[model samples]
Target: MNLVLGIDGGGTSCRAALATLAGDIIGRGKSGPANIMTDLTGARHNIVEAARLAFVDAGKDSTMISATDAVLGLAGTNVGGYRQQLEAVLPFRRSLVESDAVIALNGALGERDGAIAIIGTGSIFMSRKGAAMQTIGGWGFMLGDLGGGARIGRDLLQEVLVAHDDIRPGSELTHAVMAHFGGDPREIVKFAAASKPADFGNFAPLVFDFAARGDSVGSRVIARAVGDVEEALDALKLEPDQILCLLGGLAALIAPQLSHRYRMMLRPPLQDALGGAVSMAARLFGAPKGGADG
Candidate 1:
């Protein structure tokens, strides 16, 4: 029985899955962030630790199993030196490292060609055809990530502060946002200074809760985020009838709000992103370098 390991390393968390060639999941594990660009030492630690946990859960050992191949889908991995950084840490025979978005595309569409828009802490647009890849967004937290949770949270926070100062009409969001920051704007500012952008993004759930409860301001903010994702999808040049997969928390949650005419294009994946890594690893078992079709 061939055993393979698949890892999906993101800005916030790392997920590892151990599976057989036939796609039966033996066991799974998770750890901390694995984006090397953001935290190299921490990334290595998280990846190794997550792998070990997965091996243990699968009743195996990391060093003992000489798998035919492995695949790591990581965030913050561009097409340059950062890829090399990831290759240096994890131990594997035949390995391929790609952006987390690539794995997401694979997971959503299986082997079919299509596009995917992922909105979680951050958002990215990825379209793929076999080995060919094209990307539209995911510049980073500072200038880009327009429609992601961090963007939503940031805007909502500003509104909360503005409302507190009577610049805008107050809503339930003002109270929720204030409470999230311990009911102090100054403390919230300080926390903002020390937190990762994704940390802000995590607060989106609070906004969602309020929106679900009929908070007008919160509902509008989330609605705008939904529109932003759709605009990004439209920028991908997808045909009106082409199938588009919506992957990630925000996209899946807001699928119902999308126009009914476009509903036909929106399909959820059968498995999550880690499943993509597992499938990629399975192909690497017998695939020669630059030999097998991507």
Candidate 2:
């Protein structure tokens, strides 16, 4: 009958869930972006609001949640500054802060030893060893996010601009990107300046579409993305038999194009990232506040 709360802070939305100690979900909730680096105030508001809604969905109150453990897996909280900022708000009997990648890795592998390759707004590879951890990539959406949606979208935009200027071979993506930007090339510049990683990532589906229609540019884009992610995976020091789980948008889209050798290395996860928050909460039920249990 022990109650626990799990929070998954996505780039565009924040999701919260209430579950029993044994893992049966009781309720769910949601809010806006909780990426502290991108939007700190919005991040705190989203986390608090989502937690409130989750409690309401569970027919509980804040007091109950204050007694039960709450674990928040937030995006863009990779650094200590943002972590401390989040630590100042949010209610919990015990709470722990870590990057969203850590939660994704836990959600997939649980306590088991494995590696995770996440390709969403950003891309990162993480591996767990008992209680120890290691990572590669995760350099953020700006400089590095190779193989992520933002990267793909940036490449697509470049291709479209080149096509408009007659500097590259023509393809369906040219039209799609043009249409996506409302047929104005200047809109592309504005979009890049204003869009977040997830915003640009929204264009990834179009990349898949063009590739499916036999456009070499789109095909090459997909291949390049998959290859970049593979490089991240290969950098991990996992044993030959260790299973790697692929998370996020790009991984799911490009699975068909992945080689059998890579396929053999993958392990499908039983639960999504919210499950990781749940697991963390369970372990922290009796731990001191502000300490990590996993």
Q: Rate the local accuracy (lDDT) of all candidates.
A: 0.77, 0.80
Model 1 Cα displacement at 125 (Å)? Answer: 1.8
Per residue, candidate 2 scores C-alpha lDDT tens digits across 7-72 of 999777999888877666788899988888878888878887887788898888756766767778
Q: For model 1, what is the alpha-carbon lDDT of residue 22?
A: 56
- Candidate 1 lDDT over 1-294, as tens digits, reads 367778899877999888887556788889999878868888878877787788889888667434436678998787468888777765665567888887777777878877888877778988776677779888877788877889888878778888878887879788867886788889877877898877778878878888888998898788888788778777777776666787777776667767775677777776788998887777665333432422
Evaluate residue 88 in candidate 2 and report its C-alpha lDDT on the 0 to 100 scale. 74
Worst 10 residues of 1 by lDDT: 285-294
TM per candidate: 0.83, 0.86
